[model samples]
Target: MIDKIKRIVEPVVQDFNAELVGVTLKGAKRNYILIVFVDRIGGVTIEDCTKISRQLSKEQELDDLLGNNYRLEVSSPGMDRPLKTPQDFKRNVGRFLEIEFEDKAGLHKLK
Candidate 1:
């Protein structure tokens, strides 16, 4: 589901010279929430989010992707962003980090 949404949104984001960091789908059928996390080299502004939301919303509606009522949210990854990929880790090098592993090894802090 998310992959499909990413495929639909990534190109549009790139067109604006931004990165589509992540996409999350949550909530029940009629109350579905689609959260899109976007970022760029410097940072993402409210205007950037609004523009992406408006364009992506129209595209999604036209394609009938959701086919139901869903709230779409577009925003930037905050300070405590997740390092989901190696690129993210590399980008944050030299910055303090607090990480938690899935194996429950306990939280680890790195700098």
Candidate 2:
């Protein structure tokens, strides 16, 4: 479902020179919410979010893919969000970060 949505929205996002970081769908069957996280070399702004949201909202492909029951949100993955992918790491090449994780096997437990 997410992949299908990405296919529709990714190009629109890129049209504005932004990266489609991630997409998430949440809530019940008939009441779904779609959130699109976007970023770029200089970061994201409210205008960027608004433009993407408006453009995506106007897409017939989105309506065809998701129907009219879902809500679409476009925004940036802010500072508190964790960097979980190589691409994410690449974007923050020189920025300092606070890392947190759990050892799945408990082999190197910190506490």
Winning model by TM-score: 2
Instruction: Report the lDDT tens digits of candidate 1 across residue range 1-111.
Output: 778888898998998889988899888667788899988766789999999998987885424777667888999888788777876765556766776555478665553
Query: What is the lDDT, from 0 to 100, of the residue 93 in candidate 1?
Result: 66
TM-score of 2: 0.80
Give all candidates' CA lDDT scores. 0.81, 0.86
Per-residue lDDT of model 2, residues 1-106, tens digit only:
8889889989999999999998998886668899999998668899999999999999998787777788999999988787788878877777767765657665
Question: How does candidate 2 score on lDDT?
Answer: 0.86
- Please give each candidate's TM-score: 0.75, 0.80
Q: How far is 111's C-alpha from truth in model 2 (Å)?
A: 19
- After the best TM-score superposition of candidate 1, give how far the Cα of residue 58 lies from its true spot, in angstroms: 0.7
The model with the greatest lDDT is: 2
Q: What TM-score number comes out for model 1? A: 0.75
Q: Against the hidden true structure, what lDDT does model 1 obtain?
A: 0.81
Worst 10 residues of 1 by lDDT: 60-69
